[model samples]
Each structure stands twice: as C-alpha cells, then as structure tokens.
Target: MEHPAALAGPPIGWRDLDRVLVVRPDNLGDVLMAGPALRALRHAAPGARLDLLAAPAGAAAALLLPEIDAVLTCSVSWQEAGSRDVPVAADLDLVDRIGHGGYQAVVILTSFSQSPWPAGYLCRLAGVPVRVGMSKEFGGAGLTHWVPSPPDELHQVDRSLHLLERVAVPPFGGRLHARVPPGAVRAARVLLGDRGPYALILPGASCPARRYPAGRFARVAGRLASSGLRVVVAGTAKEAPVVAEAAGDVPGAVILAGELDVPALAATVAGARVVVCNNSGGAHLAAALGTPVVVLFAGTEQVGQYLPRFVPASVLTVPTGCAPCRQFTCPYALECLDLPPERVAAEAVRLAARGPVRTSAWSSVREPG
Candidate 1:
C-alpha cells in the first residue's frame, strides 16, 4: 500500500488512503447508530483497510460490521473532564498500537455530548497524518479535519455522516447493520433449537434512565405467548435479575440472559419475528438486522436521535414536557415511559404480524421529530 504524503491536505480523500482507522469508543447503541457513516467511509475508501478503535462496550458492534476490516478495543477511562485517564498504561498502549498500524487517516466519531479531542490526542500522539473529528471545543493541532459540531437535532447517524463530509465521504442516510459471524450463527441456532417463530423481548437495561419496568416486560412476553408466538428474553449476565423478572412465570418463555455473546444475540434477533426492547442496544441491533422493533422509549433522550432505524418500528412513548432532558437520572421517576403493558403489547403484536424484513442493504428511512 502506498503511504500518504507527510504533509497531506485536509481533503486527502479517504479513497487515496492505504489504511484508515475509524474511532467510536462508546456504547453499543452509539456504534450501531454510526453504521451509515461507516458505510460512507467504506465507500469513500474502497481500497483502504478500514479498521476500528472501539471501547469494550462498542467493540462487539464494531466486529459485527462487515465494513470494518479489523477491530482494536480498549476501555480507556474517560474522565468527567471529557478526556481519557492518560496515566493508564492501556491508553498509552493503544497509542502505541495505533502508531504502528500505519494508518494514514483516523476518523473519530463522537456523540453530540462527547469530546472528540481525547481520541484525537491519541491519534496525534501516534503521529497519524490526517485526523478528523467534529467538536464544539477547540481541537488545536490535534485534528487535521475539524468539523464544527453538528446540531443536536441531527440523529446519531446524521451526526457521524456530517463529520465525514469534512474528509469528502458522502452518500449519507443509510440503514443500520450487523454481520453475524458463522460461529455466532451456529451458537444461536443451538441455543434456540427449533423454537419456531418467537418474539424476542430484550428486557435488559442499557441505561438506568431509559429502562422500562421489568414487570411490564413480563406482561408483554405473556401477551405475545397468548398470540401464539414463543418468547425469548435476552440480557447480559449483569442484567440477570432484570431478565429473570421480565421472564417470570411466562409459559414456554426462554431466558437467554448471559447465554449469548453480542454476535450470537444479533443472530437470535435476526431470526425473531419481532423484537420488544427499551430505547437500548437491542433495538439498534434489531434495526441493523431489519427485524421489526418496538421501543419503550423514555423522553430523556431525543426520540428522533436514538430510536430504532430503517426497519419497521413502533415507538411507544408518553409525551413529557421535559422530553429530551438528557438527564441520566430522572427526577420525575421516568414518567415519559409510563406506557401500559397492553399498549406496548399491542404495538409489538402489530409489528410481529408484519414479520421481519430480511435484507442487509442500507436504507434511507427518515422520521420527523
């Protein structure tokens, strides 16, 4: 692969690059929402080896994206000051690893609420030539392509795509994606074995601020079971208690919390007739797999920015005056998510009746707030 000019231009199109590292060091939902932007990067730099630098929370989603050629993960302790814990050896090691990767360009994707300079500083330390990011904060010499921070109204997908325009990667607004590995496919097949046509209920709490009552989730599961669809509940090992509560006493309901890895979970979601989840990662995964989704949305975050994308989706949310408060702790006890089980179940059943859409292609679906 040819090396980039030592002092390259800011618009040194990703297509001309030999290697590029895309950075999204955040949650699963964040990475999943960045799918369209990653797809844009792949198109812009078809010949360039597109690698990813992800946090432990996002690496699973990064690995599931077929656009990425490789993935590197690190749990950099992001401090309250919007910077990494530089004293940690793991962060330094990441800098060293990135330094050796020979990446000509590094495109950093951050949420509207995050600081990109922390990731940019690491790229700068690694001596990467063309660093790109969007930041409201001044990036100084750390970033070669500094996009002005986008409007908060932009969805996560659009925000990342907006940043990519700085480096000349376009063709925005596409569907979410997840590529299930053969191993994960096998694992999921074994786990679900012959459980025909199930409704997947992911009752795990991705964020305390956005969680729906587990009891209501169990009711939704029971509702689906009554409609002749078997139920499968998924959650992380850490979410076992929540999963157990949501799977409680439901006839033929399968508890899969802690039993499947991210990719296997993706596979399971891919096979589901429909998915019932909170405003969380599973909803994004379902969006990626083109599985219809029902989101028990809380108004803490902008519903437009984070709701499931592309596939058929039902957003069940109560109106709140303090909608999009952006607070992780609800002082009002999450009143925005005060949807009844029957209503949530009705929406889930409605989407389930439509069944899942099977396509890996990106989409141009859009919704107005």
Candidate 2:
C-alpha cells in the first residue's frame, strides 16, 4: 500500500494539500482541546476541504467547530477497547471509504503517550499520499513524516498545537470553541429561570478514577446554595443517581442530569458564573465557553497536562506519594481524590466574583423540533 512519493520535490508541501483528513478518535475533552489546532489547519489551507475523524462522543463536539467541513466517527480499539467488536470487514470498509475520500494528505493527532503510528498506517492503507504523525519510538514504516512528540509535559491544547506547528501550521490565539444549538439558549433559559450567579456542579467523570465522591459534591452544592448562588448539578442520564445525591434537597439547587444535549450543556455552562467539576468533559466545555472553573484534580492523570488552560480555572488536588499514576483503577482506593469540600467551595466563590457573563457568540445551525 506504500505509494512512493513522486521524485518531483519534497515529500509534501502545505500549499499543495487541497483536501485533508485529520484523525482524532478520542473523547469529548480531547477533541475540544484540539480545537485551536484544527482551526490552525483550516486557516493554513483555507481552500482545503478539512475533515475530522472523531469518536461518537467526540463527534458531537467536533461538529460544533466551524473549521470542520465534515466529520467521520470511529472508536479506536486503543482508546475505547471493547466498545466496538466489529470484524475485520468493517475496518477494511472504512479504509476503502477513506481511500475514496480523495484526500491528498492525512494527519493523525494523538496524545503524547499514545502512538499515532497505527492511525498513520491506516491512512497509508487508504492510499493517502502524505501521512503525518508524532512518534518518538517507532514510526519508520507507519508515517511519511515521523515528527518527534514534545518531550516535556504541556497542556493538552499546547500539545495538539505543537503537533500542528511541527507540520507547518501557523499559530493562532489558543482559544477553545464549540457551537451552541439554536434551541440551547431557550432551553437553558427555561431551566435557569432568572437565576443570578448560578454555579454548575458536574458530579461525574467518564471513569471512576476521575470522579470525586458524590457526598463531597453534595456538600459543595449545599455550600454554594448557602452562599446565595444557585447550584445546578449536571451529568449524563446514567449519572442521575450521582447528580441527585449532590443536589439533595439543597435550597435553590436544580438537578439537571440527563436534561440537555451537548450544545444545550455548552449553553448552560456559558451562562454559569463558575463550573465546579472533576477533571471531565464539562470542565473542557466550560473552558470553550470562556467560563471560570474549579477543577477537582483526581489522581488518575497529571494535573498540569490535562487541566483546562484556555480559561480561568482553580485546580484542587491532594498531594499524594503515588499521584499522577494515570491508572484507571487505583490500588490504594483513591486516597488522593479526597479533598475538603470547603476548599473547593471557597475557590468556586472566588471565581464566581466575575459574575454571570451571559452573552455568547455560539450561533446554532438548526433548532430541535
């Protein structure tokens, strides 16, 4: 499947890239962090038809970006193992589809730890002329341009942007962006009901290792309510029990679990004075909407690398000997995740001082019926 590069000149040039496919099959937060890089790619080649390949969850946020002309979805085995158990036929079909896309180049965006060579191999299999990725260990046969991943730990946004920089994409303001659906504003307004200085409490994370205790979240919500700020606990429908536990009978506290779609949730975050949550997608969404945040830095990952950098945020984490383990299952029963609710509450109050900044630039594409 290796199509030898024509001997006319260099391997590839940015100006010659007309249609491109950028692969980032991860999660919501990961996709949002890559927002600036995506915009840079589009800006560098304004005429190119830029497409994004994201996971199902990531696809929702990806579509919100105006830079992406189209979006394709796939849950990579490395990222989401056992999520899709399709046979080899399905994978081959995708390769064939990508080959037919008529893309002149393909770029695979991955985290510093994750290897993009496998994804690059897919692009090669699909007959993409130029394949680009970051791989320090192994990538000779996988990619045409084997750029070295940054050695130092950087913010996820910076990491993605760095990859684009190595590939010749010019820099832009490091701002995260996501579009709010047309109906989101009205829906959010209806739920909030003329509330001032409301605080959003995200009580769940994609993994248990990243989630704070429900009781702690409840205490934080109560504290916020006591401070005269309306508290709204939000998460997916599956997180209803956690959200309910956190909002339990708190005065002026609303339970909005499973109530809003991605755009609606973004709208709600945009309206909130501050969002208090574990290291999760909600934190990233708030960053994109320019809202302040109080991020509970669970010991599952490095705080410096994953914490939102595009917005004002106060990150809280208990110092632990084995912290930043990046393990999904904590052998020590998550001793590092226990932080005083009062500390989180204080940070939320300080951040909410900015007051409710309600205006937004998110224009929805269509209204839900």
Candidate 3:
C-alpha cells in the first residue's frame, strides 16, 4: 500500500488500497441496514480486508455479514442525546489494534444530525490515512472524502450507501440480506421440532410508542390459533413476560423468547410462514431474510425511513395528525398502536393466506381521539 502523500491528489480513487475499516456504532437495525454499504465497499476493493466497528449488540449482525472480514466491538456508550461516551482505555486499545492492522482507509457512517467525531478521532488516532464519511460537522477536516448526506426522506440503507459512492456505485434500492448460518437453522429446527409452520409475533420494541399492546397481541394470537394457525411468541429476555402473556393459554401457541441469537432468530423467522412484529430490529431481520413481515408502526417514527424494506411486506400505521413525529415518548398516551385485536388479527390472517402483503389498508381506519 502507498503512503497517503505518495498517492495522487486524494486517495478516494485509489483501488490498490487493501485494507479498510467501516464504522457503524449504532443499534441492531442500523447495523443491519449498513450491509449494502459494506458489500459496495467490498465489491469496489475486492482485495481489501474489510473490518467492521460496531456496538456490542450489533456484533452479531456484523459477524453474520459475509462482506466483513473482521468485527470489532466498540465500548462507546450511546445515548438518545446523540452523545458518545468513549471509554479512554477501550479507545486506546482499539486504536492500537487498528494501527497494528495496517488499514489504508476508514469509512464512518452516521446520520445527518449526529456528529462523526468519535469515529473520525479514532481513525485519526489509529493513523489511518484515508477516512471517508459524510460532511455534517467539523468541516471535513478529518475525512479524506466527505460525501453529502441524503435528503431526510431517504431510506437508512440508501443514506448509508450514498457515502459509498466515493468508492463504488450500488444498485438502486438495494436489498438487505442477512445470512443465517447452518448451525442457526439447525437450532431453529431443533427448537421447533414437529411443530410445523407457525406465525412468529414480536410484540416488543425498544421504544414504548413502537410497541403494540401485549393484550392486543394475545388476542390476535388466540384468534390466529382458533383459525388454525400456530402462533409462536419471540423476543429477548427483557420481552419474555410480554411474549408469554401474549401467548397465554393458546394450546399450540409457544413462547420461544430468549432462546436464539440474531442469526438463529433469522433462521427461525425464515422457517416461519410469516412474521408479525413491531417497528423494531426483528422486523428488519425478518425483512432481510426475505420472510413476509407485518410491521406495526406507531406513527412516531417515519414509516418511509424505518419501515421494513422487504418486497412483500405490510406496514400498519395509525396516520393520526401526529404521524411521523419520531417521538421517543408519548405524553397523551400512544394512540397510534391502539387498534383493535380483531382488526390486527384479520390483517395477519390475510397476510398469512396471501403469502406476502404488498401494501397496508389497515392504516386507513380512523382511531378515536
């Protein structure tokens, strides 16, 4: 690899650079959305060793992506204030590890409003010559190539891939793909032995507004079971009680909570007839696996921005006057997800019958104020 000064002009056009590190220290859904950008970088520089730096929870998704040659867990704590708590010791250790790896370039992926300071500082501290990221703040001082942020309405995947235009062009509306390891598939089979096809319901989200009521999910599950569809409640340990309560007394309704990792979850979702979930990480994972997804959006987050990107998927939104507010908290109660269980069950039944749904008519109904 040539030194930064030895290269002509900027290192953006150089194809000979062999090692690159991509940093996306965000949540599971954001990390999954970064797959296309990673693939684009790998496609552009096939010989380049690709390393991913992400939060601990995002490590599983990063490990599953075939484009990444290595995965590094970041110790920085992220908060809704958009501030990063970079541990000094961990930062220094990561810097030393990256410095020793001899990376030629680094790409930092971030939203328009969030500062890429931590990533930029890390790249600089690690002595990586060519750093690429959007020029939102700091005036591109630390970046070798500063790409423009996409318009607000752009999908997260598109926004991430837009920065990669400096290296390569990706397909328009690129699909999100996650590989389910064979072991995970086997585990899913073992977990669901002789159960046959079942509908997986993920009723929890990190945000309160994004979560549909557990009682509503239970009602829907019971109705689905009565209609001859087996219901399986799936979620993390924090969501165990919620899923268990939702799956109550429905004879064949099983609660598979806290049993699988991301890849295993993907496999489990892949084997399912369909997935009904809140606007959460599991929804994105199910979409990536090409499984039919019924995502319930709370009208707080932008549906166009965070909704599942699968071909045949349904997005159920309330479309109230306060739709797309993207609020983390709701003061007057979350009416967005206050739909009747019968209606939700009907939609899920339709989805289960018709393979995968393309659009959502459920969003048309009005909710009482």
Candidate 4:
C-alpha cells in the first residue's frame, strides 16, 4: 500500500490509494442514501479496501452494503439531535483507530443540513493525509479536497455522488442498493406466518416532526385491510407502541415491531406488495428493494431533497404556505398531517395493485409530486 506522501501530486488519485475510510455518521436513511456514492468509490478503486465509519443508527445498513469491507460505529454529538455532549475519550479513541488503520484517504459524507468540517478535522487530527468532504464552512483548511456543496434541490443520493466526484469517483448506477440475506428473508417470512401478499406500514420516524399521526395510520391500515390486503405494521422496538397504535384492530393486520432486525426488515419490505411509511429509513430501504412506496411526508419544504427518487413513490403532503419549516416542533400548525388517510390509502392501494416496480422508468411510474 503506497502512502499518501509517496504520491507526487498534492491531490492524490484513486491509483495512489490502497484503503479509504468513508465516514457517514448519521441515521439509517442517510447511510442508505449514500449507497450510490459508496458503489461509485468501489467501482473506481476495485482493489482498494472500502470501510465505513457509521453511527449506531446506521451501522446495520453499513454492514448490509456489499461494497463496504468493514463497519465502525461512532455516535457524534452534532449528527444526533439533543444527545449528550461530545465524549472526548470516544472522540480520541476514534482518531487513534483511524490513525492506526493505515488508511490513505478519509471521505466524510454529510447531508445538506450538516457541515462536514468537524469530521474532516477529526481525520486531520488522526494524521490522515488525504481528507475529503463536501463543505462550505471552516474556510476548507482541513480538507485536502473540499468539494463545494451542491444545490439544495438536489436529492440526498445525488448530493453524495457529487461529493464523491471530488475524488474522481463517478456515480455508478445512480440508484439505491441494499442487501437482505436469504436467511433474513426466511426469518421474516416465518414471522409473517402466511405467504399471502401484504402491505407494509412503517408508522414511526426518528423524529416526531417527520411522523404522520397514529390515528391516520390506523385508518389507512383499516382501509387497506378492507380492500383484501393484509396490513403489516413494522418498526423498531422503541417504536413498538406507535406501531401497535397504527395496527389498531385492523382485521388481518399483524404488528411486527421490535421483532425484526434491519436485514429482516429489508426482507419484509422486499416481500411486500407496497410500502406506506413516513419520510424515514423504511422508505429508503423499500426503495433499495425495488418496492413501490407511499410516503406521508411531514416536511414539505425538503421533500425534493430527502425523498428517494430512484423508486416509484407517491409523496403525500399538504404543501402548507410555510412548508419545509425543518423544525422538530411545528409552531403554527401541523398542516402536513392533514394528508387524508383516504388519499394515502388510495395511493397505497393503487401501487399495491401495480405490484413491485422493477423498471428504471421511475418518472413514468411515480407521481410528479
């Protein structure tokens, strides 16, 4: 493995790298959206060992990505909202680990709402020679390759691809990718107890601001059941209560919250006729599995940016005058929740009837909004 110092140019290319550490310390949805960029890095440097430094929420998704050779977990204070202060010991430990990993380059991935300067500084502290990130902050001092942030209207996946371009890694498939092992699929099938087609409803989000109302989800589940589709409510253990509320006495509805892991959840989404979820990780996982999705998006302003574009999805939002507030708590009103259950159920039913969407004509299959 040639060291960065051994390379002649100030900015080294993929040929000069033997191993790269890609840092995406955020939630599951964020990591899933980085799939295309990860693939691009792998495609460009096929022999280079690609590793991921992910947050706990995103660790499982990182492990599931075939392109990643290793996964490291790091819960940063800036990435998670309202968390404890930065753990100085943990931060130093991470820096020490990266310094010892013999990495040639460290690529820090961040969302439009986040600044990558902090992660880049950490890499620099670890003595990583080639530090790269997308940033407009910190005067771009720490980054060897500071890619300017793209337009806000760009989708999260597209933004990641743009960032990877700083290292000359082009977009690979321009799509989301995930892996659900056959064993996980079998386990999920057993949990379902029946082979009949079912509609998956993810009724929880990482933040309350992004979640649809529980009652509305229940009504939608009932409507789907009434239409002869089995409803399956799935979420994490922490979200079990919300999932149970959403599954509310809907005939033929099964509540599997807290029972499935990420891979199993992916398998469940892949097996479903369609997925109805909040603007959360479930929607991204469904998109990766090629399942049609109906998203009850509570944040209208950033819909074009966060929502997955590579899948057939119907995004339902009220389009409030002050939409895209990007606030955890709505000040005036929760206008986005006004998306009627009837409308959402109609969209889900329509997509279910169409079954899984396999073609790349995503625009033709999905609604413009």
Candidate 5:
C-alpha cells in the first residue's frame, strides 16, 4: 500500500503530517529513552494529536511524558513469542482500531536487533498515509520512509532522534523526561515521612540475568541502614519476596514495592539521597529525576549504551568474555553482577554525598492509602 507521494514524486513523510502515531512496542525503559524523540514530534506537530503505541507496561510509563497526549496498549504475541494467551484475532483488532484512528503518519522506532518491517506493515494495513521506520534492511513497500538504523552501540535515546531526523523531526533535547505529578510527590512524602538521608535500593530487574542476588542487595541495604541512612527497597508487588529479602532485618528500611506507580516512583527517586539499581527502568527513572545512581551493570548489554546519563553514576560490573550477549539469562552464572556488597555500599555512600537531599520536600504531606 504505497502512499500517493511514492507514485507521484518523492516519498511521503513529515511534510504534512498530522495526527501522528508513534509506535514503540517495547518495555518502559525503552519508552522512557524515546522521550526526546516524542518531544520532537510534539514540537514539529504542535496542535496534532500525538498518540503512543506501547506495550501494556510501557503504556503506563508513557503517560509520564507530557508530549504524548494518549497511549494505546498492545501485548502482541510476537513480543512474547509462542505465548498461548494472545490470539491472532487480537492483532487483527489492533489493526482495526488503528485504521479508525485517522492518523496521517506512523513512526516505528525499534531496537537495533528488532525488525521494523512488521510494525510498518501493520501501519500500512491501517492505511496510515505515511509509514516511517528504522531498519538496516530495505523496507519494501511497507514503509514510506525506511531510515537506516544507526550503530548498535548508539544509545537508545539517540537512536530515536536519528529515526525522526529522516522525517524532518529534528532533535528537541538530549534529556530523559518524566513529569513528577504533584499528587505522586505527596504520596512519596507520606510513604517516606520524616525519613532522613535515605538510599533507594531497587532489587529487581527486567530479567534474571540483570538481577543481582536479593541477599547481596540485603547486605548493601543493611550496611547503608546501619549507617543511619534509611534504606528504601522498591519493586513491583511481584518482587515482594525479593524486596523482603533486601529489606527484612534491616532496621528502618521502607519497603515500597507495589506501592509506587510510575509518577510516585519518580517522586520517590527525586526525593531519595541516592539510588542503587540494576541496568533497568528504575535506573533510567532515577536519572530522569536528577538522582545519582550506583548501577549493578549486568553485562548483557553495553555499559555506555544503557547506563543512565546526565547524572553522577558509579557502575559496578565484572569484565566477562561473553559480554554484550543480550541474553535474557546468563549462562556464565551471572558473573557480570558479582560485585561485593561492600563495594556497592561504598559507591552508594559516595554518591549520596553528591545526590540531592530532599528532607525539606518531606515537610508536609498526606499519607498514601
């Protein structure tokens, strides 16, 4: 389904784009990294309705971006290949819904390893007049603008802007963005009432390969808490056991796992003295909130590519032969995240001095239910 521009003259793109749909069917961290590109789209099409197509978890996180007016969620089967839950009909319904959205352009941003043609094809099927995507392969007829993907080592934040540049959407800014809702800031204050000099320990990661042992996290938290710094261990509710293993027996350790939503989490990160986390979304979120971090850099990906930037960072990772494997699980017994708790604690303490002190922000607030 080639657009009229292909048949008439030069290929279609940003020239007359309105009601644009940005598709990034990935995790929260990926969506957060794409913030700069989203802002560019908002700037280019000021009055246009900018909708984000994200995975369910990504959809929730995407709401934090002020540039995005709305989020449409999809847990497509291909995202979790061989899953019996998502039927073919579900994908068809997504096409139907998007077709009725009246979008003039669809920009498909993908990771270096991911193929953008499938997403471009769906947008084509939806009759979006202009389909823009990034890939190394020839885009065939599915995409009107097949922008070549940048180097694998290019940061996800930069990669998004590179794709948009092909469509005349210039770079807006080079900063990770997330608006901390006032209500969520209040919630953070209530949850962490009167706690002074707290360090946030995020004990969970998107995959086991990236997760440092819960017991190791506990040791770090215990060391920090014992030093009169309140330790706040956070994760999803499903990470309660991991959170407990990290927070239990640590005096004055606050367990906010399952308590903070995206906004609340942003506030909590903003209010913390320092954040110790894996190479995960929490690391990005903390960076967006202007907090220093001590990252347990699992070697599944490049250190410079994903490690949070624009903030002071202390990364702890062991050199491994199988680095950049990009595997969900480490075959080498997770050697990359094998840093000692003492080292992690020391880094956290060092960063805490440089990180912000938000005791004044905790002065007054209602409790979170």
Candidate 6:
C-alpha cells in the first residue's frame, strides 16, 4: 500500500460549495480523530457552511469542536453482508433526510475495512454535486472524486486528514482541540469544588479486552490518593459501577460517572492534572483537550491506530508473543493487561510526577505483562 504522504499536494477548488456535509457516522474517538480534517476543511473553504453527520453518542464530542457549524444525528442502520436487507421505509427516510439538507459537497471518512458504500449511495441520491471519499469501495465508484484510504497501521486522525490531501488541502500544524463552553466549565467547577488538582481514571473501553482489571484500577486510585493527588473516576452511565468500584475507599477519590454531558466532560478532562485511561473514547477526549494521558493498551489492538498522539503521553503495552492480534475477543484469557496492582499504581504515580513521558524511549523499554 502506498503512503498518504506520497500523495500529498495542493488543494482542489470547488466552484459553488455553499453547504458541505462531513460524514463520520461512528464512535466518539472516530469523530474526534476527524477533528483535524474538519478544521482543514473549514480553513480551505471559509465561506462554505459545514455540518457534521454523526451518531448520537458521538454528537457531544462533535458539539465541542469549534470548527463544525452544526451536527445532524444520523440514525440509519444497515446490516452486515450476511444479514437481511434493511426495510424500505428506513432507507427512504434516510434518503429523504440527506436530500432535505441540500449539501453541495460531501466528505465521507471511514475505516479501511468499513466501506462507505451506503453513505456514498445516500450522498449521490441526495444530489450532492461533488462527493469525495476514499476510492476503495465499489460503491465509491459513484462518487464525484475519490482518494485511496490509508493503510491499517496509520493513525486514524492522520488518515482522515490525508483524505483532504488528495483534494490539495494543505496541512497547517493541525492539533486536536476540544472546547469547553463557559457554562460547562462553571458546571465542572461546581461538581468538583475545592478538590484541588485531581487525576482522572477512566476504566471503560468499547471493547472488553482493551479494559484493564477494575480491581487493579481501584488499587491504583488508592495509591494515587495516598500520594496526595485526588483521583476522580469518570465514565458514562453504562460504566458507572465500574468507576465507582475502581474508586473504592479512597478518601479524595470520587466517581463522576453519570454526572457529566459531553461539554462538561470535556471541561473536566481539560482541568485534570493527569488522565489514566484505556484505549477508549475518553483517552481520545483527554488528548483533544491537551491533557496528559497514561493510556493502557492490551494485546487486542494496534498501538499506532488507537494510542494517544500527543507529545506528553505514555502508552503502556504488555507484549505477549501473540501481541497486536487486533481481535475483539481474545482467544486466550486477557493476560496482557494483568499487571500487578502495585505496579500499575506505581506507574500512575510516575506519570503524574514526571509530567508527560515521550514514546521515544518506548522502543527501548521492555513490554510489561
């Protein structure tokens, strides 16, 4: 596969693109990864109106982005290859919604394995004059323009940005930025009053294998609290019990699991002294907020695609011989993240004291077990 860098060049000009729809209908981290690309698009076409189409779960992070003009929720569901066909009304409703938007250009961002076929088809049906996306899919053949998708190893943020390179959009030192509205910041202050600087422990991931042991997290929180840093456990409503259990018996440790919405969550992450999290959405959120992160990676996924990309972050990965299998279901028990609770706590303390640790030394460091 050719590198996206090899294809980088000048920006393409569109004649009359008053309204542009940027499509990334996926997870929170995926939407955040598209931030740089969206910023680039806005910079490339300042006059064009930009709207984001995303899932409801990802809408909060999308709303925190300053570059997006509006966020429209996309609830379309299409079955996988072996599943039954979607109902006609659902398909027609989706098409009608897209058509009603009246966008001139549509940019579709997708993972390498996942085709943008349905989205591309919808855009074409909506009468979008100029449709642009990666040309890997048979359905993408209908697009007005197509660029090749990046290799699997490439970081998702860079991959999304590379799509713009095909159309000649120049890179301008893009960094991820998640804004906290004034009200959200005030709300965070109220929620965490006089707790001083605290470390955030995020113990949830979309995939089970990527998550570290909750008991280990609780032990780490206890140790960090002992070391004089308040530990706050943060998660969504679904992960409330995990967060609460992880913060067990620690005096200054509190669980803000179900308390925050997206903007407030961004604000809370922004104010944190350090964030310890899995290779999950909150990890990406902390990175976007420019907070220091200690990201734990199990053997189930690739470090390059999901690890935090900020300068002052450390990725802790345990290398087994069968590492980087990228499986959602670990065939063997999850031995990769089964580090001793004391060791995990010590590492968290080290991360808190040393500021941001660089990955430059990672090549020399031995893999943990």
Q: Model 3's lDDT to the true fold?
A: 0.74
lDDT of 5 by residue, 209-268 (tens): 999999999999988987768899999999899999988688767898799888888788
Q: After superposition, how far is residue 101 of candidate 1 from its true place, in Å?
A: 1.5
RMSD of each: 6.2, 4.2, 7.7, 6.0, 3.8, 7.0
Question: For model 1, which pairs clash?
Answer: 175-363
lDDT tens readout by residue for model 3, 1-369: 323322122546436878888888777888888888887877777788888888777778975688988888775543234465556687688789879989898888886556565677677888998877775444435665666566777788888877776445454456887776777767766777645456888887877778888888888899888877778888889888898988878887778889988877877777666788888887888778777778888987677877777546888877788876667777666788877888777777777776643232112111223
lDDT of each: 0.81, 0.80, 0.74, 0.81, 0.82, 0.75
Tens-place lDDT per residue, model 4, 206-301, is 778888988889999999999878899999999989999999899768898799999888888887888999989998988887888998888644
lDDT of 2 by residue, 171-286 (tens): 79778887766677788777767645688999888778888899989899888988888898988999999999988789868888888878778888877888999898889988
The numbered model that scores best in TM-score is 5
Name the 10 consecutive residues with the lowest summed lDDT in model 5: 1-10
Q: TM-score of each candidate? A: 0.89, 0.90, 0.87, 0.91, 0.92, 0.88
Give the Å shift of residue 294 in candidate 2: 0.2
Query: Candidate 6's residue-wise lDDT over 1-369, tens digit each?
Result: 554433232344643467899988777888888888988888888888899988776777777778898888865574233366667787678778778988888888877666666787877887876777774534434566667676778887777778777787766544776766778777777887744667889898877788887888998898888888888898889988888888888986778888988877777777776788888888888788777787878987678877777636878877898887767667887788867777766776776676543332112112223
Task: Write down the worst ten-residue block by lDDT for model 2.
Answer: 1-10
The total of clashing pairs for model 4 equals: 1
How does candidate 1 fare on TM-score?
0.89
Task: Please list the residue runs of candidate 5 whose C-alpha ends up more than 4 Å from where it truly belongs after superposition.
Answer: 1-16, 82-85, 359-369
Kindly provide the TM-score of model 6 when superposed on the true structure, using C-alpha atoms.
Answer: 0.88
Better structure of 2 and 6 per lDDT: 2
